[model samples]
Target: MWPRMDGIRVLELGTPGELRTELTELTLSGAKTATAGLPALDYDAEREAVEHVGERLVLVDDSGMRAGEVEVTRVELVPFGEVGWEFARAEGEGYTSVGHWRESHRRYWEGQGCEVGDDTTIVCLWFRLV
Candidate 1:
């Protein structure tokens, strides 16, 4: 009943490829309880949705299918260079250290046409699979 595998789906959180696949898998496996995004997205309306706790999001795969779902449990704004290790660990990206997270995020942000710096504000979201 979650994916439906047919019609009217949920908000697609990730892009159309590897990142999406990895994130959805992580969510399904319950390893990933958190995610982060820039508040400067053009289509996200200043990323205000995270302000509401308990909001549900359906994870969509690159093939435009529902992969999983999650609910927002906590939200915080942290500097790109200041994201704590606890949060990084929760991302389930196998980051050995905060420095690794920063570099990986920096690469991802660059791919999105954004230049990441030490002071960049990142929306950190903690969620629960449901």
Candidate 2:
């Protein structure tokens, strides 16, 4: 079962199109799946996929808690490939792809200045809360 909110609630706003676009870019640059460890590819087919998946993505904590959720507030295709660039650099320099992805994710979050508690897990879910 998922843990209670425990006075902690985060709202992530984004658009389904935007989320799908990000996913598409990430896949093209090697994100290759849902944050849940799915092997998702085919950027060209993402629009259809997004429509099929709807707008919400849920993130569960290690303790099986639904730590938080992110709603797709906007959808846009940008040229931000820094994560992919860093991943390629790390891999080219002999770093493990997993490590590269982990570090990249860390940096991505750090860049956003997001923080979590020691016992807390962060899950990003995208959906319309209205």
TM-score of each: 0.83, 0.27
Each candidate's clash count: 0, 15
> After best superposition, candidate 2 residue 128: deviation in angstroms?
19
User: Model 1, which residues run further than 4 Å from truth?
Assistant: 1-13, 42-48
**Model 2 root-mean-square deviation:** 15.5
lDDT of 2: 0.34
Model 2 spans with C-alpha error above 4 angstroms: 1-22, 25-31, 36-96, 116-120, 124-130
Estimate, for each residue in 15-35, the C-alpha lDDT of model 1 and write its tens digit: 767878887888888998888
Which candidate wins on lDDT? 1
Alpha-carbon shift of residue 89 in model 2 (angstroms): 17
lDDT of each: 0.76, 0.34
